[model samples]
Target: MSKTYDVIVVGARVAGSSLAYWLAREGYEVLLVDRGTFPSDTLSTNNLYSNSLGLLRGMGVLDALLNTNTPIYRRAHINFDGAVIDGLFPESDGITGCLCVRRKYLDQILFENAKAQPGVTAIEGFRVTALIQEDGIITCIEGKRKDGGDDIETYSARLVVGADGRLSKVREWAGSERKIAVPTDFASYAAYVTDFVQEGEMHVEFYKNQDKLAIVFPTSDDQFVVGVMYPLDDSAWMERFKSDPEEGIRRLIDEGFGHTSLADRFRKANFAETVKGMHGYDNDWFVGMGQGWALLGDALSFKDPAVGQGLHDALYGAHMLSEILSQYPASEWKRSWEPMGKVYQSAMEAKLMSRFWIGCQFTKNTPAPPEITAAYSLVGSDRQATETFLGMYNYVKEPEDLQKEIGRLLSGVNPQIPQK
Candidate 1:
């Protein structure tokens, strides 16, 4: 006899763990499964903005996360060409700063929190092998031990969620079609370094030469995450980095920053971890709802990671799904879940589309437009403008509104209209 649950959430990382935690807290019988064990690392941006930090606090894991000794960054410095924009993170909604904890630590906190919930059952090292359907609606999930054990299990559920990732098996089985897909022409490489000082601020330094983008941010245990991105077409550069990542990063810092003291610091620092990265990640948004099934996190929508918004979107999307599911009883999921899921997905897309467009601009090899550069300069000088710009990431202001404000500012600075 198969054990039944009100909800079975696949992929127990940020999205799946959060969904399970919230749903189980609402008194539902939730079963969460993942192929990987807890405290395992995954390739991620690992940067958390104000919105994501607030979600972690809401989940009651903020104190534990703080105990992990992760650094809190209160400022951001973005440098493009020779123009530098320094901005203080607008402290609002009770969040004072941002964090950059590794996924191994952060996801484990979320997973353990979910498992501690009374109505949740969590299974690690188990992979979902198949979906069992009746009358064209998914009702049960089949799983096998990832370690090649003989134990196979089936569990029925009223609702199943694909909180996996971009390459989600659940999404494939659901036949969800991607509605928006855009491929980026860049690849990223990242590694951890110890004693790489940034003076308690996060820096996104871009250099026009080699079309390179570098992010230097502090994380837990006096360590920093240094990452670089370059054009995918530059195969020689990619091969060089693939062969010797540390030396490649050293060369990037020295070349991109023009041999500044920061570059010297990175060159002298000890690399705490091996470099890891991926290429050909496309921005995708799939159909999010189906009968007896729904998707969350990267499974539902994924954008270029340059903006570091994926984890934030995942946590908040799970929060929103829990809110929607709470309104209907488990028995009525078949009658009510899909319609609510559609409404939630539409709202999520609307909120994220503007930021998505902004992130796409960073994937290009060329420098930003003059008006955009003007905006960054304004952020460096004007405190109000800085807040307005950073507010886009915090969801306090819409991207369209911010663009209009920037345009107005630019018009005042450059009064003459150039005839095209």
Candidate 2:
């Protein structure tokens, strides 16, 4: 006989562990499975926005996080060519601000919390092999038991959640269509390197060059992460970046936007580690199940890291899903999921999708308009604008609405800074 659970969550990373933690506390028998053990390394920015922090606070993990050396992000510095735009971001409403921490620490904290919760059984170092369906409904998830001996085991559940990541096997078993790139919408690459920090305030720098855009986020311990996204069709350069990152990276930095000061800092700084060749899939970015199963975090939708909203979206999604499950009936899970889906879908369309499109729009030789430069700069100077941008950055509200409001604010006002 197979063991039964109220919920079976595959991919006990951030999304799965969060859901299992919440659901298990609600008196449900939950099974959380992951392909690796705790404290394992994962490729991620590890920056948690205010929106995500708020959700984590409710989960009782915020206090523990504070005990660490996570840095707070209160501003953003954007550069286009040699022109610089600086902005200050106020803590969003209901949340103080965002923080950056290492992934190993963050995931292990979440995993341990879930495991300690009553009725939550965490099965780490187990790979979920398949999803079992019966009568058009997902009945169980099958995986190999590797605790002592390798053997196939199954955990049945009334509801199955696919918290698996991009290219998830569970997504495949759920019958998701293959992802296709939108026309003229290409892919890009990034690499995360830890070491060195931006002085003064915690922030993300959006480098808007003539032909490329790179994002850099500064974290605690004098460490920062840098990612450069370029056209996918540029295979020769891409291949070089993948094959020999140090050589390729140095070359790009030398030719960078004429900003030798920043590039010099990167050169002199000690590299903690390198996560190279990080790529993004334009479509199949987000997928969700309609009935009997649901998806959360990257399993549902993934956006380019250019926006730095993945951690925020994942934590907020878990919060929204938790609220729905608590207030609604088990049979009504799908209905509850729909509204949450709509919320996340709208968020993606605004925060990331639009930004992705905007990034793609400027990949050509077109000069970035003065208005865009001012907009980025004003966010640092104006508290209200900073708050709005941070709110969107944290996934607290719809970014589309925030952008519209920012547009209105900028229409009548003259930029205090001269555009280069």
Task: Give the Cα lDDT of each candidate.
Answer: 0.81, 0.68
TM-score of 1: 0.92
Model 1, position 189, has a per-residue lDDT of 86
Worst 10 residues of 1 by lDDT: 201-210
Best by lDDT: 1
- Over 1-420, each residue of candidate 2 has an lDDT whose tens digit, in order, gives 379887888888788889888897778889888888888767676777776787788888988877666677667676766556566545554776567777777888898889999999888888888888877777888788667466788788877888888667777778754442333233344455565546676677777676667677766455776666666677876787778776666667656644645676666655567645554454335445445677777777665556666676667666556655667666565445566455545654454555445434443435668777666665556555666665566545456766765675667554464545
Q: In TM-score terms, which candidate is top? A: 1
Residue pairs clashing, model 2: 87-380, 88-380, 285-302, 286-300, 286-301, 287-300
What clash pairs does model 1 have?
Answer: none
- TM-scores for the candidates: 0.92, 0.83
